[model samples]
Target chain A: MTSSWLNGRPCDGLPVHDRGLAYGDGLFETIRVAGGQARLLDRHLQRLSNGCRRLAIPMDTDDLRNELTRFFQVLGQGVAKLIITRGTGQRGYALPEPCQPQRLLLGSPLPAYPPQNALSGIRLFPCETRLAEQPRLAGIKHLNRLEQVLARAEWRDPVYAEGLMRDMSGRVVEGVFSNLFMVVDGELRTASLVRCGVAGVMRGEIMVRASQHGLAVVEGDISYVELLQADEVFLCNSLYGIWPVTGLAERVWPVGPLTRKLQAVVADLLSDS
Target chain B: MTSSWLNGRPCDGLPVHDRGLAYGDGLFETIRVAGGQARLLDRHLQRLSNGCRRLAIPMDTDDLRNELTRFFQVLGQGVAKLIITRGTGQRGYALPEPCQPQRLLLGSPLPAYPPQNALSGIRLFPCETRLAEQPRLAGIKHLNRLEQVLARAEWRDPVYAEGLMRDMSGRVVEGVFSNLFMVVDGELRTASLVRCGVAGVMRGEIMVRASQHGLAVVEGDISYVELLQADEVFLCNSLYGIWPVTGLAERVWPVGPLTRKLQAVVADLLSDS
Candidate 1:
């Protein structure tokens, strides 16, 4: 419940009429914390900045960073939340003119991800809910997340960790809360979010790691056939790090080497935060 | 900017950390106000209650009525907004067990519609953005409204009142801010929002008016072809009353009798408040 502000004052809450609450018209990020610091805070900032550009929301990175720094500096550990919303608007759907953006940085105790989760991985069910194809909104962490919310609610058992979502075209998109990656023919590959999937920060990190390891990375319309035949599959996010996909519906795969190697770096990145 | 509360302690502001902002997971109703009373207050309350039932959010009708009465008492004339959110959850998508819903009511100045809008009508553009089909979420106004936000941002012109939106299946749904209807065979009809679009309060009133006049009222999939051939077209919401849609792309329609007659009754209802 702790907060830091961008207006250089002790701000505790969002304005009552914030459009974020009114319309889910905002974007956000969840960064992992380690050693009292958010890992790759700059990269996360870059994504947030990119998101603002896409949504035409004004960006003040310095103000954001300072507020975020203060928030984390107080908590010293866990997850750092960065939320930017088009402050408030009237009842109409029209975007309010001269809108003041609401900036919020909340620090929370991180959910403990099992050490084995990163290395051993988890099971996933293909959700009935489909992520609508909106190339413009694709890859950005916008607040219009009812699709994800509905998909996540499909399961109640603690046994299943996450659910995989499909695009309107019935193409396997990404996990409800993480990015999807698979090793195909010894090459590291991820689903193309050009149609609809979040361009996650951890997904970016793993891509970088793939390049650094001399593995050619590719993104495109990856079908279920392409997925099931893969050497290995994994899911990732900034908070959960990287997790090998041990089973998906009827197919199961062993935790592979590439997933482990990439996850090792993600672990170090989070642990060093 | 003015507000009222049920208990009458003091209505200064709402907590910043309300779940409404945190998740964009709330429902709201914007009601018309005039001469110190709310218009269609019962219908608005019904919509809110129906929305709460669908989302599993708790509803206390008596307390809500007291709050609404107190809210209108503070505002001599304006709009009343009632927002109810499934209270705050942790930093995740999972809904909390035994959640308490937060209620926020705010009264503010309503936008005065251009008188010429009733006479000259408006220009409309078909947006590229399409609403996804979610029967459970459709009809009711909910906080997960990024689709509407993006659709609204597609155009920015004072001359044109609003833009038209379609569902994924090429079926014309509704305008970004209001429910849409047309007169065909001298019968009044509107799009069925069972899969998308909101079932507006004014839409129901218009339907009842048509029924009282023994005019056929159709509610089903409305495609562009059927809409283009319609005798007249218009849009309506509780706040704006009725606005004749003068032109759609190249097609033109003068304000028709049915549209005008219904608009008169609707306007009277609003002004009576």
Candidate 2:
């Protein structure tokens, strides 16, 4: 069952003039819930706050946290999707003066994925839809995600678990719904988010954990050639933890030790509370 | 007063799971309604139809036209805004299977602009916000318009009637709410929509009318330096018709003969029906 709230009230609809729908003037976060708690909630909130600041949307994070605490009790063990919009506005693109940001929270059952996706591994589709270079809108998870929707639409075959997207400059950036990482010659590497792509919560956590474990994690350009030449590649998101990418097109890879170690870290983090 | 309809029903709200709000997975068109008629509606519908095709959003244009005829009568003389979204969906970026497209029609009073804007011309603000190049999403108006919102926000000073935006490569594209054109060396020029920009219905009309009158209408890249060197500049949209650009930062131009010619064409087009 799915439950939702608008501004702390149990509602399933928003005003037609809401800027979130009018111009996609908003930000969103999809958080994992386990043991009646929102996992990595601080990171999610931090990202949300950052996005709000970047877009100039006023938000009271303290109040948001309080509301989520109550919401988690109702959600229990599931996924919490939160959207913060500039709220209802008069016609036009000009930011509403004295903007009243709307907070929407929805709790839904965790998506069921095949067990083999985490164990044996999953296949990746090379998406033709390229991420446009826009440093101004890069990193933070804003609502302007047509590129992602188009990329995900490129395939319907269940054999490919995810689609890999490259930037306009032909650099391997990320998956349709997750951040990507590859183990390259003993160095852990991921594409830089300076030009484009979302700076995912799990991606950040993995970087920190890898660094603490004395691993060299680099964030920079990763070409398709460089990615295919890597020792191992993996994908990560807040909900599913980490998915080992075993195949892309005709190439195949065995689950590497580095990916296993990081997956274990994510599992421990998510299972704790 | 502003009134709205959802899926041909008199409603003011939508389900929270709408992909329009979630991912900006939709297209929208703002049309001018005059004398109980939707002016230049066929062109607007054509653009919307083209957008729906590119996004793979199933739409019946004939059905949409029938609905608008009734809506225009109710609207009388005002602006008709239509939004076609991918409708409600489960949490994910992938296109919904068996998708139900939502048609939202909003009728609101025409925006009141300074009379001097049309008579004497208007000043333009060169926006710092740069449009990202994406061929797949260019020309057709989509809902992911954070860039426009940000650019419009750059100037609250009413002295500047509109803001001009360029692409990442520093090629001047369009106005915050209108399409831009310039006259250089006796030839009409507008930024090509192949890279990135909303190809406004009025822009298309102006090009055709100019060609009919035996004027050289060209669509290609326009650099800031080239724009500054142009003999005449103007901005246009379906609602406001045409506003000759009298000034940009530290520069000014008289409303030239060609601008007057095109403005007359737009004025006649909007006044009829």
Candidate 3:
């Protein structure tokens, strides 16, 4: 069984009526760890706080920082999950007055991905799963992930690594968990999160990296043609760091130099985390 | 505490790593019970099974039916929540191999809409919250309800009965928990589920009733203008049946005759259940 920590207390089970299970009223951030520290921890907390404000869930950053520090202090190195729910509420649709705000800090062992797959890249299926545009919940990693979970369940083979999703308008949005980054017209571009998509932490980091290198960054509809024309492509999330994609659907390409350089940068961040 | 039943077993607690909490990878149906019987039991079950198939969650309906029958036999009269999740699995984004299905049935106290709210109709706020379109997950009563929960949380006044949502395109969708039916241009119309709305159980029943009465039923984009132009507007869910809207945004309307008549139709079915 997986271990758990509810509100900083060790617990074998969740309380009777966790709203996370009841209504999915919560936000989450999955992070990677190296050398006993979470990569981009501050940025993730910033995103979490921003989400809480938009959703009206109160957040205590000081307490959160301390709890998270202590959480990772014991883990040594691995992945950590921060889940904050609207907490328990009375039986109704209305947000309970005086939200008790539940917190769950979980640590898990990371799976090993072969270096070959990491370098040569993996296959991605262009999933028919379309993300609905909800700007309020867009950009934040919340608990309403059933759409992605269902899309991922569409396949069973380990041959496929991840699926690419598009918004209602058929514009490429993101991977089920990771953000999509591609090089098009000698420029780095990622799908816009203005309407629908998670503003991934790693995506943000990559944007900063691109800026540091003075690379032109575009944010808009990324079509199939643009994707195929791209010199390199990679999918990124906190856990996997960065994985270059060799192909998606029937289209195939060799792992380009840019993808490798980006991976090396991400690896450095991981090494120092 | 609210009462609960899991797989016909007696009272207990939830597992630490329920997929429902992890990924919202589950489907739920809220059944209305009156004197040892569920309202629209067959329809709700059909939806549950359809959702399981779409999510690739294998469920033995006969086994579930037996458990459900036993649960209701004990509760007699109340609301029973049937929850089916993709079961427990190792962490990460991947779908579980040989998926384990977990069915949880929880009995909740049936809520009665306030007599005043029911009779005089209720006020609804046009929520800034928009429903993202994920047709694959749309219409089904899945556990990824963070959107609805967030929309409902957009306001906290007990004075407001519910909140109305829109799609990314600014088209009116439905109330947080119910399907919207409006009389536009002297004809009946409801928000289309093709993009991002739910095909609610009560919505289906209302459609049938509308057909029997020879009312024109148009399923399409419902704008705020269409809502304003409507002579009558009402919300429908399996539990509350049908509720008329007395006020919205800057406009107001008395509960109309057609709304009352259609509500009576739903009332008869619930009484039968």
Candidate 4:
């Protein structure tokens, strides 16, 4: 990381006793910064606040916004990762009295991906690792991400850029670090995140955009067979706006018209932010 | 917290990039150190090794044993916590190439609980938070423990000593930080950790001692109804040894003979260790 900050001060380390390091009791947001501004930061903060509410972690939105502004102002163009954890505590499962949340901000140069990934598309590895269903933790981008770490380790080949993960009941969930959407039977469909999956801000953007474009957006279960039958498949995240899935398993998909249009719209929206 | 060490060095902080703080991609063990010896240290190490194998994190058992011995030798009486993270990384879910696991050891004064907890018994609050079933993540004490934190946060009343957590399927699994056991039909039974629950070291010790005593130990599904019907209910952890459950919801259970006997055996085994 090029630049980092803990709380409001510049630092490269965190207290080992932070609950985030101890029990993954935390939430993180990876934002794309351009021209010294974190793109779609409000959306990210909205999601973060929702997570804090769901997890019962007290958050001061104004203070967080001020810190984010300060952290992003010094960066020209890069990815800014923000982490908020229930602060230091003595050993025990119970929450410590007078808990104070700790925030860590990091800045890193934009990762280099092949040009073809955006123009042509990327391939997917059908990961054997499945996401567990926990409704309480389903839609929030909290720090309990061992499943994603395990899924990302399933393949080392450069041919596959991302891995597709499914829930235990054989329902396609999402990508390792992105949301999955498919154009099936001329309808835009994505798996619901109510059971198990991080509800990405980019996903919310796409659903809204699809609705504006007069496309039927279905947030429900999409079986592996159903996903296979889709005319187009795509993965999306805040950093990587969208990548059409050119290949998955034995099947292949083309960069369909809807995907191309959605990509263009998302790029425009991100640039504006 | 009295003292701390990171990678055998006296330190109170970990790098912000540590995977343990980021994704909770690690395992942890809290051992009770008494009289300059960590009680049930071998059992703790065995469970930690099992966690390492399950999570695919490389561990050198001999080196870890030596480190633990050195760490405990200087401490007379306290709770020692050991955390092994997948170590530092750049940015992404994929494991860093040639990953070196990070070890953090911390010592804290043993918590002071009321004497009545052990002599009379403790009360339980039926937690609203439910544990998700992921066999791959189950039975091992990994760092992804937000579920326990959430369950423990359900009530602020000091009346309930420990909250009882049930699985997503409504099976009485265990407590927030300990294992649960019940005596039914003159048989020693406990919820199976096969689906979702930490296979605690103390729980293992109790199981072995019960079997040696010629008791029928049943590890199977335990519904709420079954839990209520149990002649006796008790909770056990390495630190406190055992605490019989005098009340759960509206039901009450007596401090039965089996609970007393198992507690005595566990205490003896721990003392010997």
TM-score of 2: 0.98
Residue B19 of model 2 has an lDDT of 95
RMSD to true structure for each model, in Å: 2.4, 1.1, 2.6, 1.6
Ten residues in a row with the worst lDDT in model 2 chain B? B264-273
Candidate 4 docking DockQ: 0.81
Model 4 TM-score relative to the real fold: 0.97
User: Model 4, stretches more than 4 Å misplaced?
Assistant: A269-273, B269-273
Best by lDDT: 2
Candidate 1 per-residue lDDT over residues B174-250, each given as its tens digit: 99988899998887778888887888888887788768877798898899989989999999888878888888887
lDDT of 4 by residue, B19-120 (tens): 998899999999988777888778899999999998889999999888888888866677899999999987898888788999999988787878799789
Model 2 ranges off by over 4 Å:
none
Give each model's whole-structure lDDT: 0.80, 0.92, 0.80, 0.89
Give lDDT for model 2. 0.92
What lDDT does candidate 2 reach at residue B61? 95
Candidate with more favorable, higher lDDT: 1 or 2: 2
Report the C-alpha lDDT of model 4 over A1-273, residue by residue, as the tens digit.
Answer: 378899889996898789998899989999888878888888899999999999888999999899899888887688999999999876677888788999999899877778688778999999998898899999999999999988998999999999999998889999999999999877999999999999998999899988998899999999999999899999999887889999998998888888998998888645633
| Predicted candidate 4, C-alpha RMSD | 1.6
Off by over 4 Å in 3: A213-218, B184-187, B210-221, B269-273
**Clashing residue pairs found in predicted model 1:** A13-B16, A14-B16, A34-A273, A36-A76, A139-A199
In angstroms, the error of model 3 at A175 is 1.9
CAPRI category for model 3: medium
lDDT of 4: 0.89
